[model samples]
Every structure is written in structure tokens, then in C-alpha cells.
Target: MPKMKTKSSAKKRFKITATGKIKAAAAGKRHGMIKRSNKFLRDARGTMVLSEPDAKIVKKFLPNGL
Candidate 1:
């Protein structure tokens, strides 16, 4: 059988933590930050865990991760 490949896009955008949770960067902070409020910008500056349903799908792409 052929080796299963990891999704490169997923690998770049998400990370599996030591506890098996999908960690990802919050959106809306990539560009045009000058128009957003300080609070909004600050809020989008960290990682967020994927929701259960979403996590299930993410897990498929990152089988060895979580």
C-alpha cells in the first residue's frame, strides 16, 4: 500500500498539541490590522482549539497527530 500523506496546508495552518487537540491561529489578524480595534486585534493574536465536529475532520488529515 502507498504511504498516506499529510495535508501540507493543514500542517502549515494547524498543530496538534501534546494532549491531541487541534491548535490553530485565530483569523482576521493577517492583514489590514490598522482598521481593526485594539481589542479585536489582540483577541485574534493567539491559538484556538477546533470544535468537536471540526476536530473530527481535522483528525483525519492529521491522523498521527491527534
Candidate 2:
């Protein structure tokens, strides 16, 4: 059988943590930041764990992880 290929885009955007959870960057920091508040920007900093339902979909692309 041929080797299963992983989704390249998903690999770059999503990360698998030591605890087996999907960690990703927070949204809303891409554009139009000129009008955004300092608090919003500050709080958005750093990574966050994806929700359970969403993580399930991402797991499909990382078949060899287990």
C-alpha cells in the first residue's frame, strides 16, 4: 500500500501538542488593526487550544500522529 499523505496546509496552520490537543493561533489579528483596541490585541497574543469538535476534523489530516 502507498503511504498516506498529510495535508500540507493543515500541518502548517495546526500544531499537535504534547497532550494530543490541537493548538492554533487566535483569529482577528490579520488586518485592519489600526482601529482595534490595545486590550483586544494584547489578549489575542499567544496560542490557544482548538475546540473539541473542530479538533476532530483537524485530526483527520494527521493520521500518523498516533
Candidate 3:
């Protein structure tokens, strides 16, 4: 059978962790930082693991481990 093609967008935006969870950049940090609170900025500093339900959907896009 032919190899399945992984979603290009997904590969760029999401990463599979060593334990198999999806890691993605935190949202809401693109602009308007002035209106955002210090806590929000601090919490959004790094990438976060996708929830179980969300991870399940992302898994389909990454059929082959990246």
C-alpha cells in the first residue's frame, strides 16, 4: 500500500512528545499584549500539551510519528 501523507500544517504546528502527547504553542499571544495580564503572559510563555480529546483529533493528522 502507498504511504499515508501527514498533514503539512499539523506537522508544523504540533509536535509529538516522547510519551505520545501532542505539544502545541499556547494561544492568545500573537498581539495586544498591553491588554493582557501578567499572569496570562507568564502562563502562555511555553508550549502546552493538548487535552485527551483534542489530542485524539490531532493524532489523525499525524498518522506517522514525527
lDDT values for all models: 0.84, 0.89, 0.92
RMSD to the true structure for each prediction, in A, is 1.6, 1.5, 1.6
Q: In candidate 2, what are the lDDT values of residues 1-66, reduced to their tens digit?
A: 988789998888899988899999989999999999999999889999999999998999986554
RMSD (Cα, Å) of model 2 = 1.5
Residue range 12-52, candidate 1, lDDT tens digits: 88888888888989988878999999999878888999887
Runs of candidate 3 exceeding 4 Å displacement: none
| lDDT assessment of candidate 3 | 0.92
Identify the candidate with maximal lDDT.
Answer: 3
Question: Per-residue lDDT of 26-64 in model 3, one digit per residue for the tens?
Answer: 999999999999999999998999999999999999976
TM-score of predicted model 2?
Answer: 0.85
Single out the weakest 10-residue window by summed lDDT for candidate 1: 57-66
- For candidate 3, list the clashing residue pairs, or say none: none
Order of candidates by lDDT, top first?
3, 2, 1
Model 1 earns a TM-score of 0.81
RMSD of 1: 1.6
Q: Model 1 residue 1 lDDT?
A: 85
